[model samples]
Target: MALTLHGGRPGTDYDAAWWRSVFGLLGECFPGLPGGAATAEALGFPWADQTTPFTLSEQGRTVAHVGVLAHPMRLDGRAAVVAGVHAVGTTEAWRRRGLARRLLGEALDWVDERFALAKLHTDLPEVYAPHGFRVVPTHRFRTPPQPPAQVQKRLLQPLRHAADADLLRSLLRLRTPASNRCATADPGWLELTVAALSGALSSGFWHIESHNAIVALGEEAGGALILDVIAPEPPPLAVVMGAAGAADRPVLWSFSPELSCDRAEAIPTPPEAGVLMVRGDWPLGEPFGISPLWEH
Candidate 1:
């Protein structure tokens, strides 16, 4: 029995059965991933139009899959298109069948015709290296603990309401690059960033009314981890500290912050989540960082 290959933009080419099968495959491939339907409903939208998925189905059940996110970004103050490959997986029963490789080749062939660069974050770099992908140094930015400054912290409201989601969507639409060095120019990836964080980190959404920013933040023994800052303009470090109320503690920026690299220490990101891999000429020769949250 041969598997059938299906491809299309989500919501456009994928129907109800396709959603169930693909989302089911995703949950099986990655533990603790939120159900796609619920996440989309919470945001009052479907998947982004830029995302195109390819799946291998055996008798209507999706067994292997690969997703391509058309990421439009600003790299070193210029616009670039990146085909972000993600969710490449095959069921255990289908392992060693070369199903994933087939889908990957198909996806890449499509990518080559349209985009110059391609990227993906994976725990298994060896799996993709044969496809001409190489790890690129990724980083996190950090700032020294501030002297206890007395400033009224802004109020932070959890993103639990429709209005909160809408606010984030609007900001992402007009958002300035978190860093002129590297940042997403389109809102789709940002929206997916929040959607993907919908489960464990869903509570991390913090709306700073004063600064007009939606911050994805988490707490750790080290200090606060600002995962990604979504705002028209990346808020000043002071504003983020005030909003997070962490003026006296060291702050780590998972995403590139607006602050000068001189002020924030840049360190190589751990490969715990998988190394960042690329497939073409990366324009940013200088040190730069994009939030892991932006990864699919």
Candidate 2:
């Protein structure tokens, strides 16, 4: 049997049924996850030209999928296009058939035609290494056991409107880069992320006025997870923890090395840590990192 490759912007070639079916497979693979088609829709799928969906089908039924989000970023101070490859999955029945490999190849080809580089975050680096992606080092920070008492007075305002989105975008522009690899957090992406992640994180999207920072936080079986953070400086790790009300819980902060803050422990390229896989010759300098906020 021959497999067919089909793809298009979310709403055009793919409809709600297709989106649900692909996300259904993903939910089954990673149970207890809240995101899927709904998140994609909020991100302006089909309508948003930046995101494109690809699928592999056998006998007219979708079996594998991948998505690409075209993001413009500064690579060593030069404008570069980075394709964020995400939502990659294959139905359990289709595993080991090379469906994913074929789909990835097609996606990369598509990316190559329009973008300067392709990037994705995954724990399974081996799966992407053969495709020309190299592992870029990233750092994870742990919050101190006892947060500063002053943080108790600080508050995190929930994102509620366009103005708030604007603020988040501006904060993203601050901070010096140790390396050139970084995503441009335009207003559209920030709004889409805030809406998409609100359902996953109990706290949803929030910003600290006192510290000029924004964060997406959620709780999982492992305790509290700081999914993303944006700030001028390393806004106090303790304050971020306090703002999220996860002060006593085990908090994992994913950030670039250029951003500094108090940390209980510094993780150096752990296997479990998210590895960046890229295709093509996208030059990266030392001390490079992409924030968790832009992972998907």
Candidate 3:
């Protein structure tokens, strides 16, 4: 009699109040909440009807929320494209309970089998392993980018309201090819992101001609500034150097303690590392059962 499950998008019974609760819960756990109402509103996100926001309620009141997005991710081999997970959270009052587990189980059941892998980045691995999640040690890079000198840059940052959904979708397709994450980015996603990004790390977008897609988040501790999602061949440092500019502005990236690539600098710390976990199937497709055809 305590729990009842239902499907609701972002602004149903799960509107601003519910989101306020969820974001506050995150603020308690992490250093800061990345994209919340304040940022979303400023960015002009069309949040009343955002996609991929599903909730779990108690007596019709939302207690938990999580959703998926199929953003573009780069992989090692010929794994095609994939969908990804984003903005997953549960209310603080509902913590330590099996509510999240239940919600995710139900959510995955409907993710069909078209995905090569169901992917999500998480700092908590032990909590997810019991649900058949595996660990792929990964890095979350953050740096005060140093854009090339005399380089031309553009500042056409799009908020959620005026965001190009198809273009963002296309970018995701190009970024994470083999992922099975549903697309969580709507106008609101970018709206919220752009709004939050300007203040993100005190450094904003540092576009480098035909080279990078740089952007910033708010001036908070947990905020992030993304420099580039370049081809494997491009110099990884292009983003860092570009974002921080020639002055070496404050910058950092989160890389798993066990993961490695190329780093001329390191700020190794336990809290900085993260493990990637998938709640459902990998290469999320029929063989694994997480495709768009069977969506919830």
Candidate 4:
């Protein structure tokens, strides 16, 4: 039987039923994951005008799926377009059939036509290496124990309006230029980030304001995760953690090491880093950083 290829911009070319099938497959493949139709909608998957979704269907049922996010990034100080490949998956029965590979190949070809770089963070690097992705070193920082004086909770404003989204976009812009490889601070992308973070954390998207800086935070397992920090100078890690009500929980940072606390520890890269590969040449040298918030 021949497999049919379906390609389109979600919410326009495709309908909710299609997305429900895709999300259902993802749920089966990745049990315990917190993503669903609601999460996908929040992440701009349904209304992503700039993104292309490719699906392979057998008898009108989607078996394999991949999403290509048209991400604008700064590479070596030059503005460039990159495809952030994400949500590549196949139904359990479809595994070992090269469906995912075919879907990925199609996505790469699509990206090659319009972008200079294609990147993805995944746990199956070997599966994509043949497709032309190389793993780049990434740094992870662990917060140090906070001093008692810094344990007092600070006010955190929840992201609830378009104004807050605009503020986040500005903060993202302020931080991205400092990194060699980073997603552009487009308003749509920032709103997507806020939605995704809010869905993941019961507390929703949060920001803290200090005299000198503003920071975005996400909560996981009762611990705070630093999503982004916008400040003229790096603020005290303890203070940031305290503001998020994570004084007792270790804060995990995915941003640059320079923004981390002086006493923070540099942890070893995870085994999955081996599969977090990039295909095209990124002007930035090795040891670059990709924030966790921007993974999808």
Candidate 5:
């Protein structure tokens, strides 16, 4: 039988059997990681509206795949649309057949027609270099913890019910980028997925009533870590820390706190941490880290 190529949005185009095939492919390719489509479905995330996928199949079985997630982002304080390439994989039986490269070519050609900039997170930069992606430097912000500044004025509440999730979903829709340098405007889906996967969605998500913000925070042996912050207008770092009960310990930021860069040291992200690659003229500035919310 001849091989076939297919393209569509995951939410709408994928039927149950089709998803099973994709899931099987993902299981074979990714091993222990949760399938992206399954995770999104479990969380009621609207991925079909956000991502476009292309696949190659033989004998009604998916053999290879590539996905592009469209994102509204802030690049150098300017609004831009970015294409996030993800989920590239090939079935074991199809290895060395160039199926992955073919799908990548098709997906990127589609990206080039509508988007000027594209990005992907990967440990293997060599795989993508020939396709126009180059490594981009990223940094994490760090500051020593301080004593409690003042009595907390804001309250942190977890998403305990459907109402809370709804509230969080609403807030996410209105959220602005935490950084004007390089940040995502709609990070809700990825944020929720990361939280769910890390077991933080239940214990770490907190909504600040007074400020109308949601923070993914956790206390670790080393310090208090702020994973991601979602708000219409992000409050000052102190306010966020105080509300999340990080007033007295060292703080590490996974995302760029664009406003507070001067107060914290910017450290080069070790190569083993993760690699960021880009395929367009990168915006100029001190290298900024994207929120883990964009990690997909």
Candidate 6:
């Protein structure tokens, strides 16, 4: 069969059956529904119009979905913000067939005109690197023993959802100006963020809303937390840095060193970092994905 590309329309976010089917396929490729859901919601939903879902189909069948989100947030407090790109998935049958690369390429092309940088988290570095993406570091904390700064923490207050058009528009307006920081923060952006926080996957999750952010992590038995922006985002770093502070130390992880301690550094180079590749206007210590949990 000739490989075909189909773009999901505005109203076709996906029906319950469709979502179930897609998730089922993902469980096979990635496994772990809750974690996959958490990652998917964080990455996939951010693209597509707030109420809409961005999907790709092959010969009338939906096989993959990748999100393209653009709003103004910067890297290192610069004027450019990363064109947030995430959640590229394909069915098991589609593996090694170039489906995800094609789908994500479309998303990247769409955002290229509007933003200066692109950022995402993926274990697959070689896959995205060839597509113009450079890998950035994905951070996980050992769960710092004491709050880093102690500014005062407020978890999950409220942000607009993907369904709220007016509010969603407002959020985009607020998010897409600076391109150097990390991640996209639009309305549906926050909805998916909050959605990730609702399940068991949210155990180490923290949404410091007063900081205008959301972050989740699954700590492995080895004491490393796996963090890939579970929710939308928190307030400016300056705020969260003050209140919540870092978790515990003896921490070995991926994200920016600022999230850990003055002594933070990289963990083992993930196979995906070199494969996925991340390129941005701002310089990241690594190229996987920047964490919204702590300010760098």
- Per-prediction TM-score: 0.88, 0.70, 0.56, 0.73, 0.86, 0.54
Candidate 2 lDDT tens digits, 1-296: 78787875442566667666665666766553336345534434332345687888777677888878877665766776678888688899888888888888988888888887788889788778888888767665564566543443322332344465456446555633322345444434533453354443224456676766666565544766565555666565557667667645676655442343523465554565467877777676544445555566
lDDT of model 2, residue 93: 88
RMSD of each: 2.6, 5.0, 8.5, 4.6, 3.0, 7.5
Error of 3 at 149 (Å): 4.6
Cα lDDT, model 4, residue 285? 60
Candidate 3 has an lDDT of 0.43
Best by TM-score: 1
lDDT of 6 by residue, 122-160 (tens): 656677778777644444333334434554432332232
Instruction: Report the lDDT tens digits of candidate 5 across residue range 1-296.
Output: 57899875454677768767876787788763454445554657754556687999988898998889887787898998888898788988788888888888989988898898999999888779989999888887775455533323422333446677777778878888777777777657766665655566667766766677777676544776677677887876666667557655677776678664456777776566678899988875686876556676
lDDT of 1: 0.71
Clashing residue pairs found in predicted model 5: 145-249
1 or 4: which has the higher TM-score? 1
Candidate that would win on lDDT: 5
In Å, residue 245's CA in model 2 sits off its true spot by: 8.7
Residue lDDT tens for model 4, 37-152: 34435534343455588988877777888888876765555677677887788998889989888888888887787787888878787778889888777665676565623433
Ranking by TM-score: 1, 5, 4, 2, 3, 6
TM-score, cand. 6: 0.54
Candidate order by lDDT, decreasing, is 5, 1, 2, 4, 6, 3
Query: How well is each residue in 1-296 modelled by candidate 1, as lDDT tens digits?
Result: 88999765453676666777777887898764535545654564455344688889999898998988888788878888788897788988998989988998888888898889999888888888988899888777776656433344332332456665666677777777677777777774444544454452355667776667776676544677776677776666666765566756766777566442357777777666467899988877766777766776
For residues 7-102, write the lDDT of model 3, one tens digit per residue.
Answer: 433343455676665555445544344454455555444433343555676665657766655443323323233445545667777788877787
Q: Which residue pairs of candidate 2 clash?
A: 10-46, 11-46, 76-180, 133-278
Indicate whether candidate 2 or candidate 4 has the larger lDDT. 2
Candidate 5 residue spans exceeding 4 A from truth: 8-11, 31-36, 144-146, 150-160, 218-222, 243-249
